[model samples]
Target: MHHGAYPRSISNLPLLRSTVAPKRPIAHSPKSPPSTCRHYRQIPEEEYRRRLAEARPLLSNRRAKTLETIGTTKQHRTFILLCVAAAVVFYFANSQKVPVTGRRRFNFLSEDWLTIFGVSGDAYEQELRREGVRFAPKYDWRYARVMGVMQRLVPVSGQADKDWKVHVILDDGAANAFVTPDGHVFVFSGIINLCGNIDSLATVLGHEIAHNVATHSAERLSAAIIANLTSGSLFLLLGLLPGLTLAGLWTLTGGRYVQSLIYDLPMNRKQETEADYIGLMMMAEACYDPRHSIGFWERMKVVQSQSRGYEVPEMLSTHPSDGSRIEKLTQWLPEAMEKWQASDCHGGQGAIARQFRDALSHRRFMGVAWYIAVPGDWRLSIP
Candidate 1:
């Protein structure tokens, strides 16, 4: 007699209950990194937004959960499943073994493409020079010094001189330095100034040079291309899912999407480690103090700390911090020291002559020039 169906509205309301699936629980999506990296944008925000939008249509049907809304997005379970699938396919499709590390990797790359790209890269640099880029003798000194270092340390890459013509330019305001294939190295005057010494300069040069020897640059380019192609394919396939979020797509791809777009995962501390070992060897071979590496890395760490982690696009781009890099370098020190010593370090012998003798023993070169060269003899003459 009292209840009479409870006025229907009260029965249907049920406090804090579902009105169309309980507000969809706001859903529990994962916190995704930015849609792209900071390096990809010269102007940043506006340009980034523009590019993301252009790529958005690719993810058009994907759910759009921002970082704030991430907590409620329970949709990660589905994403995890898709991620597993993507991971399996990606691992198999891109896996490769590095010649140096002999470590198999999930990177899409090959030396053939590297050489091809090198041709174009060389062309591009020549164009820049043609467009009025001048080579300075001091920077040329930097180039020769760096090249000389590689020749002494990295026997495999030491002969880069034979095929790869070295180039250097002085960009006084440039805050960065980079190396291109075909032995072209660009150094900024600002970098030289900040170096404070040859050791600092050697550290920077060694890392860039290592990228070439390890084929890391080629690996980077391959990953970048694969990332784009895979992301584009994912964008299309995502429309088929229609319920997933953009953040969901990013994490599922294992940061490849951002890596492809903005380049976050391009060079982590791991690759930096590889460079450190290779670099130290090169420096030692050049008869420069391997101790310089420690100081150079320290300076970078100091600069990073002073900046309070607030720097430019590099912070948000491919690089890890100096602190992390220095720590990793520490781990490699004992091993690197052993290599330096095994090469007859401590000025006990001429590093170049020792290197040539070792090369001759390997039967790789008949007459090692640094040890066997005569001032008048252009070629090796047997007694």
Candidate 2:
């Protein structure tokens, strides 16, 4: 054929002409198998379908596993970042000093937070009422007596004009008392029954008031919130760790109860001691003999032993045991007495003592054995 006629015929033949065009060469390693040879090798349709069915499961499983691994890795990275952020927040938030004790502590609660959520004064009182906590009448003599003790103590706690209201809770046989963050005192009649005299009563009221003055309730709330956030975040972080199960995560984080028992309870006990010391000074400053605390706690020990069957060790208890409490009060007695003697309301205000004695007339054990107060003197001795 002529050269021009050959060219036209070649270009017109589609398959042969397209196959001859220059294209970029695919790179292949020298060690790679010769797969180019397999492109020419044809298998029967049934065999190809059989091979595809067998490989399909394996490929699907591998892709699923790869996706799961990537998702888990991303989840772990997110949790780690969250924990780091929480740690940074806690560090920057920092600590505060207690007003009453002048002791520094790890407290991150801001005044606004305390005002908004921490100080549930009226709310807590209403909650208690809803929970069947029978409150003594505001005009009741027992209530008045408790209020009297508070009146004498609050001013000395450096809380002048503090609208500190005392509400006497007459719970059945429960010797417990608590003060709210915004200065609402809930005194139990059982605690009054437990106390020997006005001074012992002063000890109870003063301690509860001191808890308010020091903002212990708010501090505890703040600590618990921070701990819960930290521990929960940390637990999520641990869950992301490779090969960790739910049980393993709990073991690693120690759970919320364990954290509260280890971190929060110990801190609570410390706050109790601080309140004790501050309360002792308050009672003394109010002209109530500090030594009466010994008799009061001794009676409490007897009551607790009879009721609770056994005392929880101080280290494990939220409040120091009766023995520890009495011992600590004893340690501060000297200082307390000095403050009492210097108090303008010194000598226990004989008229107030008379009213206290009259209020105690119903009790059969109202005698020197309960509280040994020297006539016309603030100094007290326990028999």
Candidate 3:
């Protein structure tokens, strides 16, 4: 109970003081309850500005991408405009008038260029010779007949001054005649048999001659060049599209087929019709009967019908159908007769010869009529 007990009691007094500490009550306001939901604090001005600054580059990149897309679209438009401009210039620059028919056409190849290209009959003849194609000798009747018809036709062909050469191919199976650009005429022996008369032979020779005078070969070559260029450009432009592949574009466009159907075959048929008109006029000018031309086409119809058993649609062929040719020839016959009557053939003995020739032509025409009427008579040869 003295001073030592006092020190021990002081240490115990700390432990007693810790265990008996008084607790204070938490204060609550009547206006608000303790919130169970989260409280959202507004972002500070500096923090908001810092986030905006960080996003600014992303917004600018999006604008740049939009501008780039607009620029690319403008470039594509400008390129298309340029191509159109070029095509317009090219069309006007190469425009020309076809001979005889006097129809407007597009031919960029000059005569010098055509000659240099060797698209002439002479070149074709040489090729034929190399291929061992037998040709009738000058002394042969078939060769003489072709030469005789050509001699009369050339003077009226408007290209009389050109070096004219005639060769009769010995192949009787090929019933065709063609003239080269450089004044070379090739006649198949089979065509002569089909003609059956001198006036009918004249029709064929005149047509071949008209082709040369019209410069059809040069026109064809020039057109081919243009068509190829157009198709190639189309292919390239179509290839630039996003979803289209090259193989898909090729299958879709079918450039060659399109060119053939839309351009080549149609153009060839047009040239053929033009040649027929020009040849009719030439034969009339040469004092040949134009009615015989109709007879010849009728015969051709019978032959074609018999051989193929089915007629090709006119659109699918390079030549006009026999019926079309006959119809046109009939339409043109009156004009040709007027020309023929104006010629020297109507004077003195020439008139008598024409009457006799016309009588023969009428007989031949009747034969063709009989053959056409008897559809069952397949045994009737054209000759």
**Predicted model with the maximum lDDT:** 3
lDDT scores in order: 0.49, 0.60, 0.63
Q: How far is candidate 1 from the true structure (C-alpha RMSD, Å)?
A: 22.1
Candidate 2, residues 1-383, lDDT tens digits: the string is 11000100000011111122236555745686656654466899999999888774545777767645642566665866676686655544445445445566654443234556553557767776665566898778778788777767755664443456777776547666766555566667777787747898988887776665555654565666666566555545544333336546666787645765776667767777887887787788788888888898887788778776766776665566778778888887887788778778842332322332332222111121222222222211110
Name the lDDT value of residue 83 in candidate 3: 71
lDDT-best of 2 and 3 = 3
- In candidate 2, the residue pairs with backbone N, CA or C atoms under 3 Å apart (3 or more residues apart, or in different chains) clash, namely none
Query: TM-score for each prediction?
Result: 0.53, 0.64, 0.66
Supply the global lDDT for candidate 1: 0.49
Alpha-carbon deviation at 277 in model 3, angstroms = 0.4
Ordered by lDDT, highest first, the candidates read 3, 2, 1
Clashing pairs in 3: none
